[model samples]
Target: MERRNCVVTFLRVLLLVLMASVETTALYGVKLKKKEHRNAYATMMYMGTPRDYEFYVATRVLIKSLVKLQVDADLVVIASLDVPLRWVRALEEEDGAKVVRVENINNPYKGQRYFNKRFKLTLNKLYAWSLVDYERVVMLDADNLFLQKTDELFQCGQFCAVFINPCIFHTGLFVLQPSREVFKDMIHSLETGRENPDGADQGFMGVYFPDLLDQPMFHPPVNGSNLDGQYRLPMGYQMDASYYYLRLRWRVPCGPNSVITFPGALWLKPWYWWSWPVLPLGIQWHETRRQTLGYAAEMPIVIIQSIIFLGIIVMTHVARPGISKLCYRSSDKTTSLIHTALKFIAIWSILAAYLVPFAIIPRTIHPLLGWALYFLGSVALLSIAINSFLLPAIQVFVPLIGVFGSLLVMAYPWYPNGVVRALVVFGYAFCYAPIAWSSVVKVLARLHVSLEREQFLKLVESSAPSGFNKLF
Candidate 1:
C-alpha cells in the first residue's frame, strides 16, 4: 500500500508540472503578440475633399507595400470619424491595418487670407502624436514611395525628420515616439495661435521644431535600442522627386536612399497616368503597387469605358459617308445669326472632344489604361464632330497632335539637364501655339465657305430622329 501511495503522488506531481508548462507557453505567446504590434507605420485620412479617393488609393498602396516588404511593424491609419465604414473595413481586413478613428482637428489658420485649399486639412496629420500605444510611429504622407524597408528608422530618437530642403525638414516622412504629453502640447500651441507661416502642416511643424536643422544625423545604435532626443535625417530619406529630373537618377550622398516624396505640383502626382512619361519616377511607384495590390477595383470600369469609346469610333466611321449624303441639302439662304451659331457649335464640339476625358476616366485607374482611354475617348468624340459638322480631320485633331508633340518634347530623355528640357518644352509650345490658334480660325472660315458653296449644307434643323443623341 505504501509503494502504491508513493507512485500515485509521483503521477499527480507530474500532471501538475505538465499543466504549468502549458500555461507558461501560452503566456509567452501573448507577450510575443504584444511585442509584434508595439511599433507601427501610420498615416492619416479624412473625408470632405475632392482628392479623398485619390489619396485613399495612395494610402492603401503605401501600407500594402510596407506589408509586402515584410516590415516588422503594424500598419495603422489615423482616419477621421467620417471616413466610410467600407474604407475602414477594407484597411483592416484586406490590408492588415489598425485604424484609430478620431475627430478632425480644427484649423485655426483656416480663416486667414491666402490660405491654400491644398493645406486646409493638413493640420489633422498632427494626430500621430496621440498614438501612445505605439512605442514608435513613422508618420507618412501618401505621396512617399519607399525604395526599401526603412525599419531602421524606428531606432531613431524621439523626433527625427529629413531635411529635403537645405534648411527646411520635410513632413513627408518623420519618426516620433508617441506621447500624450506632446500631443496635448501641440493642441495648446495651436489654440494659443502659434506662429504658423503659410498656414500648412509643413509651416507649423517647421515653427514647432525650429532647431531640428541644427541636430546631428540619426544613427541606429549597434545594440538595437531606441534613442531619445531630436535628430536630423539625411536627404536620402526623403529625396524630393524633382531632384531626379535634374540628374536623371538618385545622387543623394547621405543616409539610406530609401524613400522618395513628390513635393512638386499637386496635379502631377505619381498615380496620374498623364503625369507619367513627363515624370519618369511614377512608373516605379505603379510597379510596386501592381505587385502588391492588383488593379481590380478600377480595372473593370476602365475596360468598360474603353470598349464603349472604341465602339463609338467604329460606328461613326461606318456611318460617315451615309451621314454626309443623308444630311446635306442645298439652300440659297444664309443669315449672320445662323452662320455665327454654326461657328460657335463647331468650336464647342472640338473643345469638348479635348476636355471631356478628364471628367469620365476613372480617377484611380492604372496609369497605362488611363492614358489609353484618354486617347480613345478623344478620338471617339472628335469622330462624332467630324461626322456631324463636315469639319476637316486635320483641323479637328490639331490640339490632340500638338499636346502629344509637346509631351514627347518634354519627356525626351536626351536633354542635357532639366533646364534644357524645360526650354525645349517651352520652344515646342511657343511654336505650336499659333498652329492651334489657326486650327480654330480655319474651322470658322470653313463654316463661312460652306454657306457660300454651290451646294450649301442644311442647318442643324434636320429631319433625323431624336434617337441620334442616345449614343452615350
Candidate 2:
C-alpha cells in the first residue's frame, strides 16, 4: 500500500511539474510576442464573404509587396466566419498573416433602399483600433494596389489618411493607433447614427477625423506624416487607378504614386477579368492569385488534365481512316463510324471547356465552391467517358467506382471536412445523373442496330430528314 501511494504521489508531482513548465513557456512566449510588437506596427485589412474573397486576392498582392520591401511590420487579416477555413490557413501559413476572426456587426438600417448591397459589417473597421498589442497600424481596403512600401507611414500620428477627393479623406489606406477608448468612441458614434455622409466606412472615418486634411503641420512629423498638417499622406502614397490610363493617354509609363486605389464610385476593380479593354493591371492580380499557395496548387493539375485529354482526342481524330473513304463511300459505313467517334469526343470536349472557368474563377471567389465544382466536374467527365465509350453492360458499375474514388479523395487527411464531403457527393450525383441518362438513351437506340461505329453512324444518318445533308 505504501509503495502504491508513493507511485501515485510521484505521478502527481511529475504532472504538476510538467504543467508548471508549460505555463512558464507559454507566458514567456507571450512576453516575447508583446515585446516584438511594442515599437513595431501592422498592416491590416478587413474581408468577409465569398464575394469579398475576391479582394483577399488583392490583399495577397499587397502582402507580397510589403514582404519584398522587407517592411518592419506584422500582416493582419481581420475576417468574419463567412470566409473559408482554407483561406484563413493560406493567409496564416502561406502569407505569414495573423488572422483574427470577429463577429460582423451588421448595419442597423439594413432594409433601407440605399443600404442594400453595402456590407453592414463595415462597422467592423472600428475594431482595428482595439487591437491593443500593436503600437500603430495602417488599415487598408482590399481594392488598393501597393506600388511601393508605405511602412514609413507608421511614424505619423493616430489619424493619418489621404485626401484624394476634395471633401473627404479616403479610407483605402490610413494609419491609426489601437486604443479601446477610440474604438468605443467610434462604436458609440455608430450606435448613435453619426455616420459619414457617404454611408460607408470611409464616410464614418472621415466624420471621426474631420480635421485630418486641414490640421496645422507638426514641427517634426511624429509618425511619418505631419500630424497637424491635416495628417495628409504624400501624393505618391496612394493614386487613383484612372491615373494609370491618364498617364497612358500621354504615352507615359512612369508614375509618381506609390499605391493605386481602384475606382470606388463605379465599383470597377481589377479582378473582374471580363471587363472590356481589360484593365491594365487585371493580369497582375491573376498572376498574384496563381502564385498564392492554395490557388496555385489547383492550377497545374487542371492544366495537365486538360492537356492530356485534348492530346488523346487530337491523336484519335488524326489516326482515324483516311478522308477519301469518309468522302466517297456510297454505303454509310465510314460516315457512321466517324460520326459516332466524333460525337463521343465532342461531348467530352464541351464539358471540359465548361469546367475551365469553374476551376479558376470559383476558386478565387470561395474555396468551397472551387472544391465542390472540381469534384462534381470530375464525376461528370468520368460518367460521360464511361457511358460513351464502354459497352452498355459495363456502364452500371462506373458511378460506383466514381463515388468510391471521390469519397477516398475527400476522406484523405489533407482534404477532410464532413460538410465538404457531403457537398461533393451531392454535387457529383447531381451533375452525373443527366449525362448518364442521355448516354443510356443513346446506348439503347444503338442496341437495336449494329454496335460497330461504322454501322451506328450510317443508321443515324439514314434516319435524318433529307435537307440535313445539304446543310452539312
Candidate 3:
C-alpha cells in the first residue's frame, strides 16, 4: 500500500511539472510575438452595390495575394458596420484579414442629384485612420492591382499617396500612420464644412492636403527607419490604365513599377470581361485573381447557368423537326400581320439571347471564358427562337457575327494609337451597318414567304393552332 501511494504521488508531481513547462513555453511564445511590431495592409469595404460580390472577390484577391507574397504585415480590412457578416467572416477566415468594423462616416457633401452615386458612401474611407492597432497601414482601393510586394510603402511617413494625375494625388492607394487624434480631427473638419469641392473623399482629401502635390517625393530609407511626414509617391506605384493603352507598354521612367490602377469609367474597371479586350492590362488582373483568390466562389453559378443553357439547346434541337411539321399556309392580311408579329418576336428573342447571358454571368470572370460562355449561351437561345418560328438562320445570326467582329476590331493589338483604334472601330461599324440592314431585309422577305396560310396553319397545329388562327 505504501509503495503504491508513493508511485501515485510521483506521477502527480510529474504531471504538475509538465503543466508548468507548457505554460512557460506559451508565455515565451507570446512575448516573442509582442517583440515584433505589426503593420498592416488594409482595404475598405462598404455595402450597397449590385457588384458587391465582384468587389468582395477583388478584396480577397488583394489580401490573399499580399499574404502569398509573404509581406511582413497583417492583412486587414476596414469594413463598414453594415457589410454582411458572411463577407466579414470570409475575409477573416478565408483571406486571413483582421476585419475592423466601423460605423459609416456620414458625408456632409451628399444629396446633390448630379453627384456620382458610387461616391455617396466613399466618405466612409476616413475610417482607415481609426485602425490604431497597426503602427502603419496601407489603405487600398479594390481596383488596384499589386504587381509585386510593396512592403517598403509601410516605411512611408504620416501619409503618402501616388500622384498619378499631374496635379492631384490619386487616392486609389495610399499609406497611413494610424492615429486616433487624426481621425477625430478629420471628423471635426467634416462637420465644420471643410471645403470639399467635389463632395467625395477624393475631393475632400485633395483640399485637406492641399500641398501634397508640391511635397517632396518619398524614398524609403535603406536603414529601415519609419518616416514622419507626408510625401508624394512616384507614378509607378499607381500607373494609370490609360498610359498602358496609349503606348501598349509601361513607360513610367521613375520608381518601381509596382502597382496598376483602373481609374477610368466604372464599366471599364478591370474585373469586367469586356474591359480586357479594350484594355489589355485587365488580363493581368484576371491572371492575378486566377493565381490567388481564384473563381471557386463564382464557379458554381457559372456551371449551373451553363447546364441550363445546354438543356435549352438540346430540347430545341429535339423539337426542331416536330416544330417544322406544324408549318402550312392561310388569308393574305392575316398571314401578313402574323409575319410582322413573328418578326418582332424573333428580333426581341435574338436581342435577349445576347443580352441576358451577359447580364446573368459573373462579371468578374476572365474575358476569354466570359465571352465564350456568352456566345455559346446566346447561340443556344437564338436557335430555339429561329427553329420555332421558321426564321432565316443566316440573317438572325448576323448580329452575333457583327458583335464578334466588333470585339475583334476593338481588341486589335497593332493599332498605333487609341485614335487609330477608335477610327478603325467606327469604320468597321459603318461598313457592317449595311450588311446588318440587308440581313434584316432578307429576314423580312423570307418571313413573307414562310408565313403563308398553310405554314401558319401547320405552325399553330402543334400548339393548338385552331384557337390561335381563329383570333386572327
Candidate 4:
C-alpha cells in the first residue's frame, strides 16, 4: 500500500510539471507571435484564370505603384493549377516583386475540374496568412489599379478588417489583421454556408465584424460627388467613364487641357470610336491605350451584329404578324418589355451609368439579370411545346426568336458569344431527328390516333395490310 501511494504521488508531480512546461511554452509562443505580427505587413492578390488579364495588369500596376510610393509591403499573388508557376514568377519579377504559388484546394461545388478557382485561391491566401506573422494584410483584386498611395491600409490594426465605405466596398480592396481563428471561421463559413451562404467573402466579413472589438468600423466618405445618391469614390481612384460623367458632367472641364469624357453612352464604350478625331486624347484615355483601341475595333463588329439581330426580329414580325400580335397583346410580354426598356433607359440617363457605375452597385444585380434572362428563355421554350398544337411552326418560332433575342441583347455586352453559341448548338440539335419525331407525334395525336397504340400495333402487324382481307 505504501509503494502504490508513493507511485501515485510521483505520477501527480510529473503530470503537473508537464502541464507547467506546456503553459510556459504556449506563453512564449504567444509573445513571439505578437512581436512578429507587429513588424509584419503583407498584401495578397489572386489570379485564378488567365482570362483575368485586365485584373492582372491592374494588380501589377497597383503593386508597382505602391512600391514606388515607398511602402514597406510584401505583395503575394496566388494562382491556381491552370496558371503556370513560371509565368507567375516572371510577372512578379517584371515588377521587381515576389509571388508565392499555392496549390488549389478541392471544392465540392467546384469539383476537381476547377469551378470555383477564385474562392479556392482566396481560402489558400487566408490559410497562408494565418501561418505567417502579419500585423496587417491587404487583399486586392488583380483588376484594382492603385493610382495613389495605399500605405494608409497598413495603419489599420487589431480590427478584423478596415476598408472603404460598405456601400463602396469593392471587396477588391480591403485590409485585415491576420488570425488563426479568422481563418478557421472563414473555412467553416465556406463549408457550411453559414456566414455568406450566397458565397461572397465581402458579405461574410461585413457580417462577421459588425461589432468588431466592441467598436463600430470606420467607413470613409466618398471623395467624389454624391448627387445621384450612388456610393462612388473619386475618379482618379477607380476610374470608369459612366460613373465619372454621371457624378460630374459629360464634358467635365477640370484642369487645363484636361477634360474627362464619357464617350460611350449606352451601347457604346470609348474604345468603339473608329475615327481618331472622335477619340479623346491625354488623361481621358482608358488606363490602357490597347484597351481603347480594342474597344474601337470591336464596336463596329458589334454594331453590325446588332443590326443583323434587329433585321431578324423585323423579318419574324412581318412573316408572322399573328405571333407579334400575341406578344404585344399579352400582359406579361408588354409589361416585361416596358419594364426592361424603362430600366435600361433610367440607367442610361445617369451621366456616368455607362462607365463604372456598375462597380459601385451590388454585385447581385448582374447575377439577377442573368437569372432573369435564363428564366425567360426557359418559359419561352416551354411555351413552344404548349402552343405546338395551337399555332403554326413559323408563329411558334416568332415568339422564341423574340425571347432569345432579348436575352442575347442583355448578355452580349458581357458574355459576347455565349447566347449566340448556345442558340446555334440548340438549333443544330432541334433540326436533327428530335424535331421530326415531335412533328409525327403531333400530327398523329391531332388525327385521333393514339401514337403509342398505333406504333405498337404497327410493329406487331408488320406482315398484315389494311382494307378487306380474304375471310371465311
Cα-based RMSD of the predictions, in order?
10.3, 15.9, 9.8, 18.6
Quantify all predictions' global Cα lDDT against the true fold: 0.74, 0.54, 0.74, 0.41
Write model 4 residue lDDT over 1-472, tens digit each, in one string.
9999999999999999999875543222122212312433333455555435434443455455555545556655544445655657655666655554444443434443323445544544453345345566666544333444545445444443323443323344445666666666656665775544324445555565555423422223346543344322222133433223123211111122112233233223232222111222212333433322223423454445445435644554343323322422333333445645533432232213123223322221123332343333333333333222122344333434444444444333333444454575466545544554565455434322211334423332442233212220
Q: Quote the positional error of residue 32 for candidate 1 in Å.
A: 15
User: What TM-score fits each model?
Assistant: 0.80, 0.53, 0.79, 0.38
lDDT at 220 for candidate 2? 43
- Name every residue pair that clashes in candidate 4: 55-142, 55-143, 242-352, 242-355, 243-352, 246-351, 246-352, 271-295, 271-296
- What does candidate 1's lDDT look like per residue over 1-472, in tens digits? 9999999999999999989875543222111123357788989899988889889889988988888878889888878889999999998889988887767778899888889877877888888887676788899999987778878777656777766556687788888887767777888899999998889899999999898756654654565543363224442445556545211122232345577778778888888777876776787778888887778888888888888999999998877645544433433354677667766776687789888997888866667777778988999999987876667789878988887787678667787777887788888889999998899788777656655434333433242345552441
Candidate 3, 157-268: lDDT as tens digits: 6777666456677777777877767777888898898987678989888888888655544554565542463224442345567545211122222345577778888889
The weakest ten consecutive residues by lDDT in model 2 span 245-254
As a whole number from 0 to 100, the lDDT of residue 159 in candidate 1 is 79
Better model by TM-score: candidate 2 vs candidate 4: 2
Worst-scoring 10-residue span by lDDT in model 1: 25-34
The top-ranked prediction according to TM-score is: 1
The positional error of residue 383 in candidate 3, measured at the CA in angstroms, is 0.9
Please give the distance, in angstroms, between residue 248's alpha carbon in candidate 2 and its true position after superposition: 20
Candidate 2 overall Cα lDDT vs. reference?
A: 0.54
